[model samples]
Target: MKLQQLSLFLENRPGRLGAPLEAIAAEGINILTLSLADTAQFGILRLIVREWDKAKQVLEDAGWVVNLTEVVAVDLLDRPGGLAEALKILEAANLNIEYMYAFSLRRGDKAILIFRFEDPDRAIQVLLDNGLHVVDGDELMSFVP
Candidate 1:
């Protein structure tokens, strides 16, 4: 299964990051998970949200450059080497992960990892074939605050 992720290009300066976040908050949108990677001049803020379309709209209307990316959410055990085990499976299948971020729920002994892969559909198949649970879009939204 694949989910849509929001990527925002923000300048790497004080107060620049909060503007987009505040815009989304004003509309009552919930951020599921996010990752920020920066360079000298700007940063890429990758976010997972349930209401992606609305979030994108608000950010863009506020003058932020936003992009939609297809990403996969995979469920893994919340234990040591759980990620390593999944990585080994992808390695055997020759699937490359471009980037990933993870979050663990307080109620379950499981972790949800958002992954951007070179081939998302193929990666999902490989993960399923290897007995890994691939989180679907609806299931992911259920975890949103």
Candidate 2:
């Protein structure tokens, strides 16, 4: 199970982030979840949109350095230790998590976790065997914000 995450290289300048947002908005693609990892000069804006392929194309045509990455999406209980329990499973399976971010849907009992792991296939199987629910890009996008 995987979702397409758009990673755009953003300069630390005014309106740099706005362009991408506007592009996606213009195409009627709703952003489900987003996170920004920044430094002094630039940052990476990771976005999960309702339409992955369209969003990617829109961003690229607009001259943005956008890339599509397959990330794991897990449904976790909205409670304490829910994340810990999932991490424990990944850790025990020797999966290295490169990055992760999560968000709660407007009407749901579970939170969606987006993860980039060292070994995606193996990690997916491990999570599945361990009883964790894994969702794909289409399924995950269906829960639009």
Candidate 3:
């Protein structure tokens, strides 16, 4: 299971983040989740939205460069050592994690985590083989609670 994420490069300055967000908001696109990481010069804004294509168009039309990247959404127990167990499995499979972010919604003691792996296909297979649940895009976006 995989999801498409929109990434935008933003300059490290005040109000730079508001422009693209306002544009997306103007189009009535709701962001499911987002992660913002910054360095000295620039920041990378990663967003997961139900209307990804529309959101990308809105940003691009606003004179911003948008990149689409594939990431995996995983269903993990909201308990101690939950993440560690997953990491251990991945480590055993020799998979590399590029980055990760989490959605705040807790669905019945389950937490959804977004992971960027070097090889997503293999990682998904490995996780499934270990009896882990990998969430599909539709399932992730359709979660009510």
Q: Estimate TM-scores for all models.
A: 0.95, 0.91, 0.97
* Top candidate by lDDT: 3
**Which prediction has more favorable TM-score, 1 or 3?**
3
lDDT of 1 at 41: 99
Candidate 2 regions exceeding 4 Å error are 104-107
lDDT of 2 by residue, 93-135 (tens): 8999999987546337788788998778998999999999998
Which ranges in model 1 have alpha carbons more than 4 Å from their true place? 104-107
Between which residue pairs do clashes occur in model 3? none
Q: Candidate 3 versus the native: TM-score? A: 0.97
Comparing 2 with 3 on TM-score, the higher-scoring candidate is: 3
Report how far off residue 62 is in candidate 3 (Å): 0.7
Model 3 residue 73 distance off true place after TM-score fit, in angstroms: 0.4
- Clash count for candidate 3 is 0
Write the residue-wise lDDT of candidate 1 on 99-128 in tens digits. 998843532888889899989999999999
Residue 27 Cα positional deviation in candidate 2, in Å, after optimal superposition = 1.6
**How much is 18 displaced in model 1, in angstroms?**
0.4
The C-alpha lDDT values of all candidates are 0.89, 0.86, 0.92
